[model samples]
Target: MEFGGMLSLDFYLHQNPDGGALLDWSRRLRIAAGAARGLEYLHKVASPPVIHGCVKPSNILVDVKFCARLCDYGLHFLASQERQGLAGYVDEEYWLNKSGASKECDVFGLGVVLLELLSGRRSDYYQENVINIVQWALPLIKGLKFSELFDTRLAIPFNIEPLVRLARVALACVGNSRPNRPCIAQVATILTNLEMDLY
Candidate 1:
C-alpha cells in the first residue's frame, strides 16, 4: 500500500525547499505517464470502476523513482460537499449538481494535472488578469506557442515533440465538453507511448 516518499506531486511541481522544481522534463514525463496509468486502472481495471473525484496534484504522491501513485480515490463527494480543494481542476459541469464528479470530471482534473506538470503552475493559480492554469495554457497550446507554454524553472527539452503531443492530449482532456472529452484510457495510451519514446 505504501509506495514511499511523503512528498506529493505538487511539491515538485510548485513547492520545493530550494525555491525551484525538483523534477526535470524526463522525470515529469515519467510521473505523467504513471499517473495516467493509475487513473486508467481506476477507470477501466478496477472491479467497480472508481472515479477519483480529487485528481489534483496533491492527491498524486511521487515515489522514490518518480513513479506517481494516486491517493484519495473516490473521495469527491466529501470534497464536493466541503468544496475545499476542488478548484480549476474540476470541469464546469462538476459545479452543476446534476452532472457532478463523473469519470469525465476526473479526466478534466487529470488534464489540469498534466498542465501543472508542463507549466509548473498550480491549477488554481491567478494573477491580476489571468484566471487559472487551463485558461492560460490552452491559448498558448491552441496558438502552437509551445515555447511559451513550458515551465521556466526547467530548461525546455531539445526534442519538444513529446511535450507538444502531451499538450495536445491536455487540450483534448480539458478543452472539450464533458461528453466530448477523451476517456482516461485514451489519455493513458498517449502518455504511455510518450514515456516509451523517451527510453
Candidate 2:
C-alpha cells in the first residue's frame, strides 16, 4: 500500500519548511488537470459511479511525472455522526444533505484545491475581505488579474492563459447552486484542455 516517488500536494503547498511552493506554473497545471481527470473517472466513468466525498490538496498525491492521483476517494463510507470533511475543502451543504452530497460537494472541494494550487497556499487562506480562497480569488480572477492572484512563491510565466482559464473553471465549480456548478466531466475537460495548451 506504500506508493513512492509521490508526495502529497499538501506537503508541496503548505508543509514546506522553507516557506515556498515546490510546484512551478506548468507543474501546477498538470496537477490540476490530473486531479480533475481522477475526479471525472470517479463521478462519471466508474462502473458503480463513486463520489469523492473528500477532495483536498492533501488527498492529491503528485508523482515524479507531475501526475496527480486522488487518495481518500470514498472515505464517506466511514462517516460518523459528526460532519465528515476537511475544514477548507468540505461544503456545509454536504453535511446538511448527506445524500451523495449530490456530486457538487466534491466539485466544490476541488474548486478549493484549485484555488490552493493557484495561490500556492492552503484552503484556509484568508484576506481582509475574504473568508477563504474562493472569496479572495474570485474577484481578482474575474477582473483578469490572475497574475496578481498567483502564488508569488514561484516565478510567474509570461503566458498565463492557462492559469486564467483554470481559475475560471474553479470559480464555476464553487457556484452558489448545484445546477450552477460545472459537472465533474466539464471540469476535467476544461483543466485537461488547459494542461495541453500549456506546452
Candidate 3:
C-alpha cells in the first residue's frame, strides 16, 4: 500500500524524462483510467456513495509501475449534502451550498486534473482565461485541431483519434450542467477503452 516516495501527479509529469513518448502517454492513460475506476467504485459499488470533494493532481498518487491510486479520502463527503471544502476544485453550481458534495462535483474536478495531465500545465496557469481547461480545450477539440490544444511537449501523432476520445471524456466530466456530466462508471468505461486502444 506504500509507495517508496510520495509521488504526486506533478512530480510524475516533471520528473519523467520521456514525458512525450508513446510509452509515457500509455502510462498516463493507465493512471487516469485507474483513477476513473476508483471514482466509479466509490460512486456505484460502495454501499453508500462517497463524494471525493477534492480531486486534483496532488491527491492522485503514482506507484512504482506508474499506476494511479487515489488518496485523501478524509475529505470525502456524502453525495446528498452540500460541499464545505476546497473552492477551486468544487463545481461552481455547488460552491456555496452547504448541502454536501456530490458525484458530479468530483467529476468536474477530475476533468480539470485530466486536462492538466494532457496539457502539462497547472490548472491555475489558465485562471486568467476566464474559462477552465475544459472550456479552453473544447473548441479546439470540436474543430479537430488537437495540435492547438494538446501539450506542446508531447509529440502525439496526427491521428488524433485517441486524443479526441480523451477530450470528449474531459468535456463530459466538466459539463456546466451537473446532469450533462457523465457518471464515474461511464467515464471509467470510456477511459478503459482508450487505454486498450493505446496498447
Which ranges of candidate 1 are over 4 A from the true structure? 17-21, 125-129
Residue-wise lDDT of candidate 2 within 1-199, one digit each (tens)?
Answer: 3488888988888897643545888888899999999999998889789888789888899888879999988877676646434555766676576574558888998999998888876666333454777777888888888778889887877877778787888888875567678888889988888888877
Write model 3 residue lDDT over 1-199, tens digit each, in one string.
6868647775666556654453366777888898898888878887777777788877888887878888885365533343333545667777555654688888988887777777775565334557656667767767878678777776776566876788778877775678788888888999999988977
lDDT of 1 by residue, 1-199 (tens): 6864657888877778542456888888898999999999999999999999879999999988888999999877665454557868788888776647999998999999999888887776434565799988999999999989898887888899999999999999999999899999999999999999999
Model 2 / residue 64 / CA error / Å: 1.4
Candidate 1, which ten residues in sequence have the lowest lDDT sum?
A: 75-84
Judged by lDDT against the true structure, how good is candidate 2?
A: 0.80
* Pick by lDDT: 1 or 3, better one: 1
TM-score result, candidate 1:
0.93
Models 1 onward score TM values of 0.93, 0.88, 0.83
What is the lDDT of every predicted structure here?
Answer: 0.86, 0.80, 0.74
Which one is best on lDDT?
1
Cα displacement (Å) at residue 104, model 3: 0.7
In model 1, the number of clashes is 0
From the highest TM-score down, the ranking of the candidates is 1, 2, 3
